[model samples]
Target: MSAAITDGAVKALISQLGYSSLYPPQEMAVKSGILEYERILVTTPTASGKTLIAMMAILKAVEKGMKAVYLTPLRALASEKYDDLKILEKLDLGGSKIRVTVATTDYDSSGNELAGADVIVLTNEKMDTLFRHNAEWLGNVGIFVSDEVHLIGDRERGPTLEMMLTKIRRNYPQSQVVALSATVANSDEIADWLGCKLVESDWRPTKLVEGVYEYGAVKMSDGSKFKVESSGVSSAVDLAIDSFNGGGQALIFAETRKRAASLAAKAVDGVYKRLDKAARELAAGASADILARGDDSELTKTLAQLVAKGVAFHHKGIIKILTATPTLAAGVNLPARRVVIASILRYDSDYGGSVPISVLEYKQLCGRAGRPKYDAFGEAVIVSERGVNAEELYDHYVLGSPEPLRSQLSNDSAIRFHLLSAIATMPGMKKPEIHDLFAGTLFARQYRSATV
Candidate 1:
């Protein structure tokens, strides 16, 4: 109930989206002038109404006859956001219909087809490619939104995203920037880099109960303990079955794809027996759909069988249980009532050994729990394998804060690639211009120097 939400267009948009009132984070965003085109950075837990805040700003931009560009770190995320924004197309604000477009492929073209789009969604790499191609439509974008903006700390893709934001800030100083992120440790530094009003909160619509699974019981952070019936398979499988018995879905994060498939295979019987007639029918349909894809490989057949039993791994379809690798943590908005981490360790090629995941990654996995409007509460459990201390798991992942985000733009290859792109995009750009452009990056801000 802020002044911004009182506007007719805003009210209509909210009602159209079937929301009776803004969540606390959304209200905080509005109070910070998000609808007024203020550059705002929102760092909150998942399912906390971050998308609604971006939608409000997009609506405001469309109202002024200016376009909005929504950027994501992954193509799957881009498609998800595009589908979410498609709802806005039904609204006619000031006699203007919002048109949404997604551009994640075909990097060679200038994206002229997107000129008429009111809202354009693109992955970070795709946006960088569009900038290189000098897409004319980009000039009309009044608002730039970066979903999963916390990926700025990532090693591989961080430099591109960091550079993209820096370029946007430098080239479009008047445009509004709305950065939506998961709860990260160094949110203030990122907000300062973008000159955005930092709105940080831990508020979630559904309560999140984090726990560590050891032996055959779960000890939650809230001082609660529950015994999980032994499935004779694994602790993670037991946790998933417990969730299904309570009329809830579960997402299990495995260390590898093979392990994910193995875990799904093990949980099939438990999950299948719990489904009712209607649920079984739906699962059968999903299984058939998977088989109909024409892959016909042994892996595909195994997956189809798992799907029929209301379980699957790495494959997308309707199922009560899904086991996947950590890649699913950041991509799409697939929530579950319970999230079971099968293993917190993954083999790293760089180190040639298993390494424990960061608290940020753990938070991302746990954030998948608790779907809004569906579950009253969510549970996240980390399974402690033999030789791994349960107390360490509890202290590091369940009770720890995420690490601070640092820039990955200082590397030679990243610098070279971005510098070359800058030179190619702006012909005859001298040293000072290049320096100025990079000076806007988080690397320069954090290091207190742009020495290149």
Candidate 2:
């Protein structure tokens, strides 16, 4: 154990959280003086104690009579993190009670209700809106924790996240920043941009085995092989059945919501057949609960029917198999014993045809495999499509490294929106001031100020 972990408050918090000792990543963070206000970027595998590292930093901030803010890209993730951090409210830090709050709606307000909170969790957009509103309480925050920091590469939401970090680093230089991200190829660059120490690791609690499925056989990276009995429906459903028979749950990822729902509907019969009496009764109870909500729409009725048979689509619950679109891969901690990728290609409007998914996206989906404690090893299989070379698919998705993190701030709409936001926030700012503001961004750091 490090000096930071053995300290009084941290040790007590760890005991309360039921952790016997810090994992390797967490231990490395503590050794880097994270609790003493060190800025750090931790890039590690999923379920690798990254959240604990952030929690430790938040605890230190709260103990100092200052506030800590946690930022996520999605509302669902914000809710999940809020629920996780709520446990800290039970701990007494420096004789003051911890107050935790979450804000994901009403971005137009100044969020005065969050003024007294010791720890606040929010979606990235909400935090940006507060900055735009000039929320006075934000100046008192001692630490800012950004979860899933790798999303800065996304085309849709990445610009807002990049601008948020740029503003925080430039405006609040005194505050500590603890960035948490999945393992990416260019994490060192991101760390350099944040001026933080880089803590990268591949260590995970449960081993992950990557594989490719073709012709009813799955070839694993660890030199193992298994034949999935054909359910004559789909390879994904067959893989789900194989996983259930081996006494584990399966999560299948489809390219689209429609495909996910179709696969889940097809999987109901096979999953229900494998369920024991107790599981079947539980599934029926879940189905009844869904019906009790009284949506009565066709989609809800179909989902309720699927739940009764131990299957579901696009939502998390007690079920044997869950099929979801790639959106589920974004920082949602729904781990399973087996993860089957139904398709590696998705339709793209810009390209005017189907395009292969990026290696980073594939890795994100693979991270969901291997339930911690329940499965000794989790399997991630990419199904081979017709006319596509299986060897090529395996080489690119399973064996290749994930893509580097790049900034999307250069997009035309993003540039216009953020520049106007800067003008509105600063009021009477000049061109040089605007240049200086954006020059602090990761995009400017990567491409130089001339581009900005």
Cα distance off (Å), candidate 1, residue 171: 0.7
Q: How good is model 1 by TM-score? A: 0.96
Q: lDDT of each model, Cα atoms only?
A: 0.90, 0.90
Clashes of 1: 0
Q: Can you tell me which runs of candidate 2 are displaced by over 4 Å? A: 1-4
For every candidate in turn, the CA RMSD to the true structure comes to: 1.5, 1.2
Worst 10 residues of 1 by lDDT: 1-10
Itemize residue pairs with steric clashes in candidate 1.
none
lDDT of 2 by residue, 95-214 (tens): 778999999999778888899888999999999999988899999999999999989998888999999999999999999999998866998789999989999999999999999999
Residues 116-195, model 1: lDDT tens digits: 89999999898998899888888899999999988888888899999999999998999999999876698878898899
In candidate 2, how many clashes are counted? 0
Q: After aligning candidate 2 to the native by TM-score, how far in Å is the CA of 335 from where it should be?
A: 0.2
